[model samples]
Target: MRKERKMDVDDEQVQVMDLEAQQKKTSESDLPKIQKKAKHPVILKFKDVVYKVKFPSQRKKFFKQTTSSPVRERVILNSISGVVYPGEMLAMLGPSGSGKTTLLTALGGRLGGNLKGSITYDGKPFSNQMKRNTGFVTQDDVLHAHLTVTETLVYTALLRLPNTFTKEQKIGVAEEVIIQMGLTRCKNSIIGGPLLRGVSGGERKRVSIAQEMLIDPSLLFLDEPTSGLDSTTAQRIVSVLWELAQGGRTVVMTIHQPSSRLFYMFHKVLLLSEGNSLYFGSGSHVMDYFESVGYVPSVPMNPADFLLDLANGVSPDESEDIVTVKEKLIVAYKNNIANELKADLREEENEEADHRKEANTEIEKWPTTWWQQYTVLLKRGLRERKHESFNILKIAQVLIVAFIVGLLWWQSKITHLQDQVGLLYFSTGFWGFFPLFDAIFAFPPERMVLAKERSSGMYRLSSYFFARMVSDLPVELILPTVYVIITYFMGGLKRNAASFLYYLFSLLLSIMVSQGLGLALGALVMDLKAATTLGSVLMLTFLLAGGFYVQNIPAFIKWIKYLSILNYNFKLLLGSQFKPGDTYPCDGDTKVCLVEDFPSVRSVGIRGQFVSAIVLVIMFVGYRLIAYFALTRIGVTRKSRTTKSWLLCLD
Candidate 1:
């Protein structure tokens, strides 16, 4: 009786599992079908594509044992060749160091440095036109966490699509992509990740894909779209890619490990091991080819697992070692498929030169005008900052600090001249420190996002930097204004209205200069901890060089004061505060008297105010220019291809 009860319970569990599976199928079926479009065939062919790069000392340890040298040259990808036709989804399968992402970047036209290859689209050599018509979805999704799905895609479409598209047309395209990506249910939801509350991981991934789809490129490349997702979610993403391919767009993506069901969705598979192709053939024929080569799989084996295991040095032949099996497979692939690819490419090469020329000419033009990019980026910047940029905490911090400072220097009188000087110094330091730190934290997190957008040719670096700074000016003005209003009267400065306004303007200039320094520092270093440390050290040096700290210095080292932003600010403030033709009460022994009928204007006269303001303006523009150069150089890093994506993943 007990045995029968156990059997009945097992049967009940099986039935429940079947019911859940049925429900999942029903839910998926209820979603809208993907819209179809006319297919444009883009035949991508590469021959003897070799990528050789210098391995910095830090990265040399990851490769085979190398000699001790200052610089090392390593072949990342060796004599690789393959072809991916239109309407096909090619899956690049490999272990971590297999250079799958590198290959993808090379094909997508983002790779730099020493690359030797012949890559052609259609029958002509690859050109800028090919790049313009291609879209790349990185492994790490880089979206504004504060923006909703619809907002993010709208902005992307506006920047990426042609200028001929009307604003309403851009919006329509965004909505269509949203529905195509199956993100309609969460269209209005924010794309929050670790730092905020919003959409799920699956939704975020879809948003990234949706963003690239806005351009309607003939070719799309994705780097590990299924990584970090569950089996069910991974399968769903693959199914979406399959639907995309059905519409005539060529899709290529690097996949780490896909389930057996997901594996069959690919039209072709390119298996890479240590940067060399082990096999390049139809997805269905991969197993048959391996079996023909004597790597027979057990019944009902997961094909993806079997291939990954083989690439990772798992040998099926008991008599042969793992390395031997890999070599055998590589040799067999080259002998069978490599020559055929080259021969076929030769046949197609003479077909069309005029068409390629026309495409190249059309691709030379920017999709949108410069003014359009600036306005769109400006809007995006403002919207992204709405929630977190001016939070209660920042306002409270400024007010509390201002109140404390006001109390410390309560209604300071001219009789206490040293106290007044101290107040001036303190105010300069406060404005310089807070604005600098605020700007420092602001740019590093956005560095990755900027890199991703820049790589996609979304806008000019100058436009993005200008738009960001312009958007930030309003908030930058607020804190310094609040500090001045609260403390100016309490500190008891010159009572004239013109004098007060001059002082406020000087403080604003100083704050903006400080903010520029922060942006430069953050852009100089991609790592937060490193940037913070460097910024602190530089700030301390500037503080020492500021005039209030050390009045007289050796002539040789006196030049340091010029680099100190605070020194210039203080001079402007002091110059504007005192009248030129007034006598000051002085002690008999003192060279310069603090308590007097009228203060001396010898150190930096009224002229200093105008000169310093001009200098501050120059500094603001200078730092921003440096930041732009830094960002452009940082799109690719030593660590990985998805540097910006990794940055977005950080809180």
Candidate 2:
């Protein structure tokens, strides 16, 4: 029996080994196919690229009279040139004032200046195809702070991956990217900001990189990926980047001073100073180039540190003037390296013309359908903002305000017509301002995120706008509904179910109108302080013309009352609470009723209530349309003045 058991165990072990060997053989066979699929690598080539900004003429004060000087042109990048091939990482190293970022932006097709010269991907001009295949990581981490790492990437993948990919496939892609970027441990961690506690700096940076990698971009550009990390963490980040380059990505990053270990990881380095290229070559041969140019450092030092020192106009030989050293380096680069780069670029360009002809025929479309974008964006918006919308403090604020208002006017008599009218007006005005301020913050904080996503062509502007409005509607209306329920009963308004719903409906419509205006103002200004100030002034004007505060506004200014959302809201509220011919008790021996004749009540007559509602609905839609138009004009979409003007006329 023992012998038979031993034979069975040996057979099982042999079977397991055979299975392992087959699996290994399968993986090895698949490796070349994967590599071949990714072998259509993008090569970035730039030649004589120059960026300049024109400063307006300065006004001079002479004898108390102002005279303008001629406009001056400041060169941000002065004829910079370089090439980055696939499977290579290029680092742009410089001091504070150098044009490393400017050149990087130019190559990324994001620079907004008088940029001259050629920048091509795979010897083709920048096109939508190139844009789709390129990924850019900005310096500042522009992720939502409340979302978990996995949530962030998953939403990005859903919105960004092609519509051909199923939802499960997109999710699987996000998970694969997370694992590839080594973020599995912090996949569930929140990306925190100044006031929140969550992931570390290294994790946040990794999340940013992972976000770009979700699309498997062939070309990647990063602006200072290691800005604030410690040496070890920075090295780890660079190591990940090295692996990405090894996968046939052309990676270019503007780096601040890097540690020696980090420096060696880069395959190529471009050193710049004052908008001029100092050196551009293989990272390991930089010292050799400098030594050949007769500027070798006397002592061994970190290559990055030594390069930065030279770029900053510091000389290895103490006797050389800084200005002279800079001129010499620039001259040496122009004389020795520029011609060779140009010749290579010309040869490559000749070889790529046929390839470009074939590639140019391909058409690009949005990755997701409109409905798909809306659904994914809606889900993401709900998850990201649920915390802010339903936080304890915000809930408490609404409850406290409701309780206070309810107690202040608790169970007033029907005869108290003035008190009832005051309550109705207060409800209109409170909702008017409550949602305005809340909605004003919507677009300003999100401007960066919106710009980033739009640049990447993740979804349509209309889809995003509609999804944002739809997601905000429920969250924005809940508090006001609660406020009405508390104050309506305690304040002794009409107790009928229809009347209650009407009151609720009127206040909610008012909130929607005000929220639309807030969105418009926020999108228009896009500056928090400025938008808030403008909103305060606009709301105050509306309040004064709302018929309760100034019943008989001046004729020239009376037109504003029609424009005031609160005016229509106040009228609707009055119509909802009081019916025609309603009366209240009067102070007299005969008890003559005068509620119907009250000036404030008569001004906001109970009739034509539906007209007020129709107008409110129009304004609600109009304000949102204006906000959308403003966003399109301000880079949210391709600007079309004809479309904007036609829409405004229709509105």
Candidate 3:
């Protein structure tokens, strides 16, 4: 056993060495050359960009205070200005709440507020074409945990790459990006989550970068790419970004305090404090700039650490007031570095006038067709969610419920009219709640991924909505079908082929309608706990009004039954089991009686079975439509109008 363990350890070590060598080679040679030939260089320039948000403020009165609060504006980015040219990586550094991320978002054309600014790409205003060619890497990696690195990238390529490229070509691009990002070693590993063990954190971050790199974007913006990483891993990530910039793509990233080695990788640095720019110039010149302004560091320290200290109002000279030092730095930057940056930006604008016009005139179009998007999304949804849908826990729950219902009403006789009716109602109520509670959790977790992809203009909201609906139908229905099959015969309901077929159809329709309600609730709320709570209330109401528990509902509130999915479903199930004039043996030596006269049977009459099915069908479609529209209202496509307004502002 000891020898075997040693052999396994040796194998792992060898793999690690091989991976390191491959990564080194790729970073040195492959990455820089990968996109150089196809690169479209962009110069990102922003001048006098100011962003402010409104918040409610309550004013206390000495005599009588009102409950209402007036609105007040707070500045987030105050006249911040900088420029980043192709082949340069600009790092924005500051402490928390310094508006580093806010500025980055503004430059990426994603910020919305009372934003006053001029942000241009290649001397042109923001446009749909510019959006297509830009990449924004968010701080939280929004990725599906079940997909492997290759699968994730390939699907992204298919969805986002232009349709002119053959499917095979798009796939090749994904593979090339995988190699360029040095992800070939873990190409087949899952992008795991908190509960699952998959790739290392460094590898996962690389995969996120690789997804954006597949398009060979001319401009890239990352919000704290090196956050939560060790010094070595952070250095490696910045190294990759440096190589990407070297390939002629302008890169801008917000980074927190970095080591000296990592700090020097930035070509230019922007130091911000309280929404004010303290310095904007070459990274190497930051120390000199600070010294010239009479704030030199007394001891050797990492530039990032020193800069952060100054931004936090920690003066190099402890005797000097920190607030005075910060004010002096801000004033000095406005007088010196800010003017130089504006001059450089003007010169570059004049130099690129013709190129800017041509770039702005380019037409905008989706990369893939609606049908293609639907198909790809459907396949991906199935692959990612199949395990959850068919896992042992879910299947066992359904089976257990089925067996319990069957045993409790085992071989119930038609003479026992009450027992038979009770079994039908229990089945109806079980399915009604089972599918609903399961479905309410669908969209909350996926909201992040949806927003990320939709912002990138990957696919249409309609395509994604329909794909989700279709993909869930087949897998979601299987257990319900199994449950019905188990309980139908064991409970001794009608034994004929026609009776069984009608019974199965009714149950299946109920499951689907219930599942649709779940999706609608999930999408509408987009909060797991809130949606679950709402679903519980709704399912309980439907169950109570389903014609079994309550026979004499008030006329004013009886209309709720029309809206209850369970009401229609119970009617269909009753019709399937008991028909008109069906006689059942009665107690006290009675010969026969009409089943319809019973309170349970009379409440849910056998009439209008066809109408009930039609109502269910409508509910299924109507609920999904509500979900899709709710998603639109929240964020999916609503941002397009915001993007247009942002573009107009740049113009």
Candidate 4:
């Protein structure tokens, strides 16, 4: 028994010693024996990308807006070689001056550049359809500020989803993203306004996330996720991204000044300082590399921040060795045997993406016929186009101008022909034509919104063109109604009110025709200054050639009078109210007073409302069509229809 006890004691001591040895080994290994290097996980191949973006450079002169400037030397991204794997999250990190945003923008196909490299999805080259599966959320939240959280998500779902995703599917998709992103609390709140009125910044960020996720993108790229948010909020945003990465979707984010919370959210970190890479792989391995050098990372600190401080240099002036050290670190991370393997793997993935894309039959992803889709898009555009201030200002000007002019005419004595002719100048040629301002000021604002929405696939120029015509009818009619009624009542020197009413209608038609022409002028000249100048020129031309001031012009210029919408309408108006032999020439004794009607050429032509209305209304229609065709062909973009097409399928 004593011998057995001694043996048991010896065995127990052996076990304890073994345990201690293992612990010692772990402690030493965790600290790194020599310099430590990180390893790259296998990269997953994405499908192809087709990114063609045009980035407008600041021109030396404004003339570049009208006359084309040299197409910028486009950056080519024909094929991006890096293949981020399914289980991994790759961060594009760079120095402040480095082209991180530029790269992101190029990758997303938002910026037009020289794209030489072919970016493959799996193994196949990129196609339009392949790109549809990828979601890119820009740094700024591109959302309608007026919409509530639910409204936004629902809208996105409606627009982006396929027809196959039924109402339940949409609701389910939105709800899932909301839960995953921690947006449950403020899902009902408005997007933005006074801080008190809407969702918090964090919530808005999630809403953006939910919007992108509406299509269930396989690869999601977020450009500078932490740009405008507070540290805590930024961290929260990162956490949601981590949650997404865990769900098997690859996430690539360009992050700046990440809080420790954000750092912890990342499973891997690719540290880029300047255009060169500093480190890649597990974030936990970062401290060991620095420790090998003389720099010791402090505790309770953000390692990313600590690393950047060292990488940028302690002061403006960096020692030669530190600069060399940063370069060497980057070279080791990106150029070593491990990196070679990662590169090879990425290439293979690219080839596979290409093969898959090329092999698959292309499906028509667009929702409906081109015309039908545009019709829907136009309706939406038209609704947005009807800004309230435009009509309000126009109607007020018309009523006030007509009333004052008529009152002045009523007060004046109609004693002689010259006096009546002078009054004709006061009524037609002299009255304020402020309604033309609508075309001048309005087109630019609508143009900006249209450009933006069109870029995103919001609507078509044709639909917007038609809607503008339809909506503007009320807008156009309002002024004419005011002008006609006010002038008819206020001007008491009426020969025959039925004839006077014809004059009012004719005047209304003339103004509307001018307004349409002005709108066309606005669309033609993109710049506000140029458009304004053109508008002034139009007004001058009409007033001069409109027969009030100038009785006769050259035969060639006389044709210009026919072209002058003002001339046709105004001519019919004056002719309509003429009463034959209602003459004034030399007064008394069978000698009529010198007068406009007493002239031999004073015989009336057409006086009916139908004549002027037909001419002016036809002119308006023709002008609108000209604007539509020009815009549809040149002014509007093809991308607008794409987004709308994507939206309709969701519905």
> Whole-model Cα lDDT per candidate?
0.77, 0.82, 0.83, 0.56
Q: lDDT at 188 for candidate 2?
A: 96
lDDT of candidate 1 over 1-651, digit per residue (tens): 445535544654564466446434633673344556634568888778887666445544565886766656666677778888778999999888887887888788777666787777775665656656788998988889999999999999999888779999999999998887889899999999786999988788889988888888788999999989998787777777776777788889999989766776788999888778888888867766787677865433667888987888786555677798789888887888878876765654335556566545646445788899999999999999976578899889889988998898998865556677677778888888888887888778987698788778788877788898888887799877988888888878787889889889988989989998888888888678998888888888888777666666578988887888887887777765665543333464355543323232233334556778888889878887787777767564223333332222121
Clashing pairs in 1: none
Q: lDDT value for candidate 4?
A: 0.56
Residue runs of model 2 more than 4 Å from their true location after superposition: 1-39, 60-70, 347-356, 587-596, 633-651
**Over the stretch 126-177, how does candidate 2's per-residue lDDT look in tens digits?**
7767777888998888899999999999999998888778999999999988
Q: Model 3: runs farther than 4 Å from truth?
A: 1-38, 58-65, 347-362, 634-651
User: Model 4 Cα RMSD, Å?
Assistant: 11.8
lDDT per residue (tens digit) for residues 60-135 in model 4: 7654545565543222222233456655667655456444554454455444423344444455544445455666
Q: Which has the higher lDDT value, candidate number 3 or candidate number 4?
A: 3
TM-scores of all candidate predictions against the true structure: 0.88, 0.88, 0.90, 0.67
Write down the RMSD of all candidates, one decimal each.
Answer: 6.6, 10.9, 8.4, 11.8
Candidate 4 or 2, higher TM-score: 2
How many clashes (backbone N, Cα, C below 3 Å) per candidate?
0, 0, 0, 50
